[model samples]
Target: MLQSIRSASQHWLGKIVLSVIFTFLIAGVAIFGVEEFFRGGSSSTVVTVGKTPISAEEVRTAYQNQLQRYQAQMKRTLTPDQARAMGLERQVLAQLVTEAALDQKTTDLGLAVSDAAVLRAIQDEPSFKNANGTFDRTLFYQTLQRAGLNEPMFVREQRSVIARLQLADSIVSELPVPQAVREAVHRYSTERRAAAVLSLAPSAAGEIPAPTDEELTAYYDNNKASYRAPEYRSLNLLVLEPEALAKPEEVTEEDARTAYQANQSRFGKPERRTIQQISFPDEAAAKEARARIESGEEPFEAVAAARGLDPKQLDLGTLAKSELFDPAVGNAAFALEQGKVSEPVKGRFGTVLLRVTAIEPGSIKPFEEVKDEVRKEVALRRVRESGFDKAQDAIEDARAAAKPLAEIAKERGLTLATIPAVDAQGNDPSGQSVTGIPDKETTLPAAFRADVGNDTEALRTKSGGAIWYDVVKIDPSREKTLAEVRDAVVQGWTKAETDRRLVAKSKELTERLEKGEAIETLAQETGLPLKEVTEIGRSQSKDDLSPEIVERIFTTPVGKAASAPSGDGRAVFRVTAATMPAFVPGTTTDGQLVNSLRTALADDVLGEFISEVQKSAGVKVNQTAFRRALGGEY
Candidate 1:
């Protein structure tokens, strides 16, 4: 049976029959019962689920496609090591394993799609449709060719995909979500609270004494990692943008004039008219509509309204003659006086009558008036066309001769900038942002990964320019001595001590309030101002009270007190009121919450189903073959 299946797959009609039968027979004994059915046996298989063998080539192809997608997103090519570090191979393998499990289950259930259904799907694909919105055979074939697939392979794959989709839809489609669950989520999210909060400033810590030398030393020692400097690199950058290389003095009068003539349309505005139109099925209907408007039997807007057209549908906004879709309509529209309707005109689509509402006259600046601007424009264009290539060659030649970037810049008239010291985040040793780094996103990462005195590769800019960089010096990160950062350390210790004292003070105050003392009485006694916040939800955060305080407010019962860290000090808040609005079904917010919960539940159910299927079918991985497929050593 297996030999006959293979033989049948060689013919066009037989291939379709094979596909229809493929899912039913794929789990038969001929394939799964024999361990050596694969061409290269177990060595070529990365993973096997039930009767399905996921080959090394399949893994490699999937991995490469994923890598290409990542590269396209980052806008830069990534090395194999970088992809490996991202764990893309593991993600791809896991996804393939899940898909194989699904496929196995589908086959085990004898799921199959007919050839006519697959053909209908192909014809329905929008990518294979022509301008007339019908299937184009040539377009379908061309698209398949571009995707590196033929008719038979695509049909077979599509058949399998549809079958797997059927299995998944049966498991998860339109799963019911309970109303009680929706109400619970809505209540939790919409619950609001009111709290009376007393602010505690750092000074409330009562003038924290200065730390002694022993204390400061111990503090610095305990938090040495915070005082360590980041690794910094000194760099020289050569940027080749159009403006930097443009030399307006080099542009002659004749050249400027030629450029001005070539781009005259860009330097002037064209005539534009605001027009309205009403179309008819034939010229006679258009003529009748025009005569009615001309004879004052009805206004132009009334005529439009009679045809069930709104003002927006009738009015074509201001457009130039070239911008109009139909030349005949455009000509008639432009010829009409403002507020006057045109005669019946036959346009490309149909017959129409046009009304010109307003017109703006065109104007162009004289050559002499814009000569200086034209010269600069020409000079920039000239440099932009070939400046980067020339600069790159000069830099390469200078590097081969061991000349410094500054010297190369002076000789070749390129823009060279020197950054004395910069961290990986483009900050200096003092933590000040270092400005004027061209293409910093690309340059900084490359610079940090480079060795000192080595020429880094040229990076492309968004504006068709290029930047080359060289790491000049490296400043290794090291822990700072207490003396080197004594001021910063003293400040840190003071803040920490102040916060500790403030927390203690807040706790003491909170305990008093919890013990039946009125919050207002305590606030007045402590000489602190108390503010009442109302309608604060779980997600609310204010200037004085942070989200942490808001969370504590919601968690505390009414009339109960809790303490949370605020900005610089701590806040002691007493919950005054709590409210949970009644959940109204089918409200926008309720509907959104219901949809979100339903989606999450559906995903969980589908995931569990797939996992169970995988367990029942059994999954085995050849670690050596998997690693080899990912370009790793066995």
Candidate 2:
């Protein structure tokens, strides 16, 4: 279903329908930072496309939205200057102008979108879906309200977008690509290639000696960004996991004996037998075979062989009485005498003959023998049952009394531990983790968000215990001193030196190859094994060689050596062979190539249509609004 939907979006008809629906549904949610910038009203217009007006408020909101989206995608915050450098503001402006132009064209053409179409599109939106997957009116209103648009205003915007999409789709739908063009695309995407790789890893240089103080300092200075510290918070943890709550000494002799008696079947094994049999198709056939065996006319093996059963099939092997889950099979096997063939008996799968070769009798250990194990299990169960209730009660009481975690722990027998300071990555200033905390991923994020004295909700662990914590303090991020990260500095220095040596070694080998020396001879000289990989496509991933090396092999001239950094070292390569598959006619064609080609053409047409509209109805921009969005006064 998903594949069809995806393919439909790529296909011409599906594209038109999906585009209309998509544009109608998503109106203001794509607007970046309305809550951040739309704090007050403004009368100024930022852009005027033909007769349509886009207010300064809209531009600011859109620009901020664009900034935030970029920041999220890049996973880093950007300053106003950095955003401008990335052309974020320009991209947002282009989008707004294009949309406004389309809206103007829709108005000029007098395109009419039915109220029912708009309503249906809105109702079908997944964002408005409730837990039962039906549209919830309350969520619809709330979502629009959050984006700073009332229901009427948002619906009006959607109506315009829908009309524009209808006009655009009519112009761009059914764009076609030639069969030869599609074949070319398929050949390029599916073609495979092979390479022979000789990886020169840092290990080839052997063990690296320790760096001196000067070398370490230089390495640290060059790579301070790698050592930059993350924001850290100090926290007080309330450990409520089963491992923390369980007490071994709580169980007594009486408890152990009671537990043992209740679950005795789990402790001791039952008598077992190694049995064999020949299955027959019917009662008459099995009875006939039994009679013949009894009269010595037909051997049991001969009967089984006549039925086309192998020796392994005839041997059922040793199994405990309880191991046979079917009651009929177990009953029949147990009733048979040792070394004697029994009469055909009815079972679940078919009729069966039985012979018990050996019987291993069962035995049970005395209560005293497993008492300690039973006592531990009983103690763990008791603690698990009581721990959560005890912790929750104490936490509530502490909240009511306005008492600290340390005080409550003393009063309620809870273990209270404090982490002085740990980064978001869960490491302290010395780069050691704040250990002994259960559910670190859950607890640490919650701790960072919490302020001192703010109570946190209980996070249940996989085990039946709640991990509770409170933020005690926040330690602002700062650059680490040389002494704090000396070990890391030394390690970096050693790696740099090793990589340098390896690169020099690789350069020597490449130079030798250039002088007509074979790679096999070079491998022998360097005491490294030469490896070859055949028919490796560009998509084939290699653990020994980095992606750069694989790409280099394809691009490198067949005889000329190319080098790339490989795992702190370097790899030298020369392409021995290259083959590009011919575009074969009549390969599989399931509309995939046509879909991709149509999608590309349709996109270009839509883009050109929007641009033509923008050109025909020129956009007027307000410089004041642009500067204000870029941290300037209006």
Candidate 3:
């Protein structure tokens, strides 16, 4: 099932990196001198997936894209060294394997997309549309060009993406969230109780009787596995942030002036034009209307009204020249002498006559206009460069004084801030960017271990950053104290109790049902609420079931009784129900069925093709090469 799901999602790799990553990296393209195209290098062979050979070039492109995504999102640098450590190169090669495996499968199955369908899909994409809601060929071409893709490459990529989606939909559509499963999920997601939960906190119980020497010995013997600590290594780390290089002292008035002057365009507004338009179905109509205006007998609006047009209806007043239609359209309008009407101008939306009512000239903004912003920028840069030493000294003094980070910040007039929980993978809150610094070449901080004590002095970093960590006190491994294991033990105990109670209850209920006890009566006796859920289908929301209790009810035979453990040791059940999901009457004949059948047929035969490729290709993975490229041991 997992392999099928993974194969189904083959498109994820080529779906374009997230826009957030793109935004950050695209902006700094000039800073790193990163080339978009694959540069020629001594070609190296990588693992081949099926019959298709995965080239060093392919792996490099994928790796580079991954690096850019990390850097752009994290606003840090990523070096090739760390990539080698994570087996990233091998991972890319694996992706190529998976893709080739699936593509061959697709080809062998004879599944196909028509040129007409591809064209329609392209037209439907919102990114390719003009303001008038039709595909703009020039804009579409330009966008692809910027992304370093050509028409054929883009189309081929799209074909694979669509094919992959078809494959996924085939599997997912068949596996309807079974009504029973849906009910279970719904109950789990939505059911809430007003019970006053009192935590049996071990802390509130006080220093547990310093376990008698005998008790400690017994526990160690019974659960020796709990006492082993995970292997850990302490490493010196270096961190370099943008602010580390910025120094307020180094930002002279002259320097500020120069920066302000050099980036003058950033402070200036684009040239704007206030314009109006009138459209006609064809150029002949537009020309005829223009003749009436030149003859002085008909007003533009009057002639338009007579021709069954609402002259004011299409008024797009005061649009910035850049915002007005396309460049061809806007240029035509701007070039026309003020108050003079343009000749029939052909555009993607048809022909139109444009009149420029006003022109707002573009001008360089005075430094005074953006002085406060410049000052802030200048100050920040300077502080980054000069304040590092002060920050370092402050940290050292704080350690000696045993003062808190807040106290040190207070004295230094700098803010002390906290970053929220980062995961073991180094992911941020969004569960992306395995390294907290997205752009930087860093891996998970191997220094952070479960054993690292809380409230320790700031751990200095190699990147010029420091972490004044108070490890959030997670449950320790077996090697830690017994008190740390108490919660898990109690949780296990409760679950076991619930299961035992539920099994007995189910037996009792089944017996009573055989003897004809009313379901309502049983509910009343047991103090369990009896409620009827209607239209329960394969797609039922899990919230309605409360901890998966509904699965037993739905799966039970209609005339039989069943009970399941639910919510904190409570047992829940139903005696019988006549209604259960079979099939919607017309769905078998629906177009959806045809599509599903096509997909299933394709997937079934795909494995044979992959096997054939495997037989043909002599594939070997150079684990050492991969590890070296990624920068660490495989």
Candidate 4:
């Protein structure tokens, strides 16, 4: 049966949110920000959350950002084609759709966070806490700036993020699994069945008949998509990885010595000192405490405690100059000789009285002690230099030669490898399979673009490490010859035939049922066994019916028939009987286990809601524009 045409505005809105439900709605909102700016025509919006449109640009940007983040986190680089093959693009856009829906929901409900709340949240964050244990406004501003968000925009965005969180919380909090329901679910989950095992192996039936040309053709026609070869790209790339140019074993004693000597300041010892502090709630109290300490009878600890001050609270430890809070404090502490007490000094937080407890002079490690470490650094540097020289030579040669890429690679002792095909969308032919030569990274260059953007000349490109590539061949997507797709066409035809037969059978059964045929008799007539589902509730049928199937079953009246031709010509069913299953108290260990199992199972499936806002908005992607944006002449 065809899926119901979801023409309702709510249903379409839900679809948009379905795309980017993960980054939450914030990503969708951000996508909403720059989506309209794309040149040519805007990419279709998969979803829209509210009146805010989420275009293809939004999904694409979000996807690219997500991919880049993933690459950076994994410390790997992806070729343009490799990224597409992995369906990083589609998956990313899908997530954006989810986000778009959530965003719409948020808007519909009028959920919002205030700017002040966002500011407070930022100020309260421990990461922004400065030495004084308070949110340093400057640091907070600077950090936001570093994150590419100015104060106002960050606060505004953060407010929205918090609002979205509130909405999520409301959704989650209201989703309660009742105790009785949970227990019942647990029982079903723990329920075990006894069965006589049987195996029907295809191998046991030796030499299965060769499919007739008609059967093959039918199968191929039915499953043509599966058999069509995926888009493939052959690319040449240039890469510059630090490891490729540097080797650890190339440092000489002289090189090590020279390296260590030239950078001796970096290896020098930190100057150490001791200091004391007198902290107070107010500067007046701190000044008075200092005065008493200077006047001599009051011990620093006693005076501090009498003033209800914590002596260790504000004290800078006996630390190296590099560790000191202020340059003045460091200078004064280091200047004092051993056992000398210094005058009271005013500092950032409070007045401080300093005393030099002991002086530890700075010293560098002996050359012999650090020789090994120095040698490693020197050797690595040499390797990098040598590698760069070699890479430069290769680039020069490639640039000068009209020779084939394979020959150039062979001459330079580099292996030539082919990259998997990427579609105009930059998706891989394999659809995100992790299997490949050199495991994707070594084989794919960061700049391995198949389109080459109208540039005919092969240019040097650098990726994560020293791996370099030369574009050998660029194969554009083209209609395959019948010979190439004959097998696929046959498979598709077979599947289609199977489906047609199943549909006819289902229709015949439905007509018989309408004519007063019983379900048991129908089951016997067909080979499908009746599934004896006892004491089953709508929730317990989660495994049997995914959310989609479960919803359909519940919507059907108890006595009404509900059957759908599922995948591979399989038909599904739900039988309504005069007698409902009654709960049986625990009679054995297995029964008790079943009860516990049901409860645990109930905990697993709860609170799933979606809104598709994009379809409602009638978003359309300009495929031509998208390909152009991808630097491809589609």
Best by lDDT: 1
| TM-score for all models, in order of appearance | 0.72, 0.49, 0.53, 0.49
Candidate 1 least-lDDT 10 residues: 1-10
Flag regions of model 2 displaced more than 4 Å: 1-104, 112-165, 176-187, 224-231, 236-418, 428-471, 478-484, 542-545, 584-591, 607-634
After superposition on all CA atoms, what RMSD does each candidate show versus the true structure?
9.3, 15.4, 12.0, 13.3
Q: List the residue pairs that clash in candidate 2.
A: 32-65, 194-536
Instruction: Pick out the ten consecutive residues of candidate 2 with the lowest summed lDDT.
Output: 1-10
Taking the tens digit of each residue's C-alpha lDDT, what string does model 4 give over 371-459?
Answer: 87887777656656566667766655775665555665666665565554543344565456433333244344333443443234332
lDDT of 1 by residue, 365-469 (tens): 889989899999988888877774686687777778888778878887776899999999999988899998977877898889889877566776656677778
Residue lDDT tens for model 2, 184-207 = 777656655545556776788778
Ranking by TM-score: 1, 3, 2, 4
lDDT of 3 by residue, 346-375 (tens): 976888877777878878788878766676
In candidate 2 the C-alpha lDDT for residue 136 amounts to 81
lDDT of 3 at 296: 85
Overlapping backbone residue pairs in candidate 4 total 83
List lDDT for all candidates, in order: 0.78, 0.70, 0.53, 0.53
RMSD in angstroms between candidate 3 and the native structure over all alpha carbons:
12.0
The superposed Cα distance between candidate 2 and the true structure at residue 545, in angstroms, equals: 4.1
Per-residue lDDT value at 312 in model 1: 80
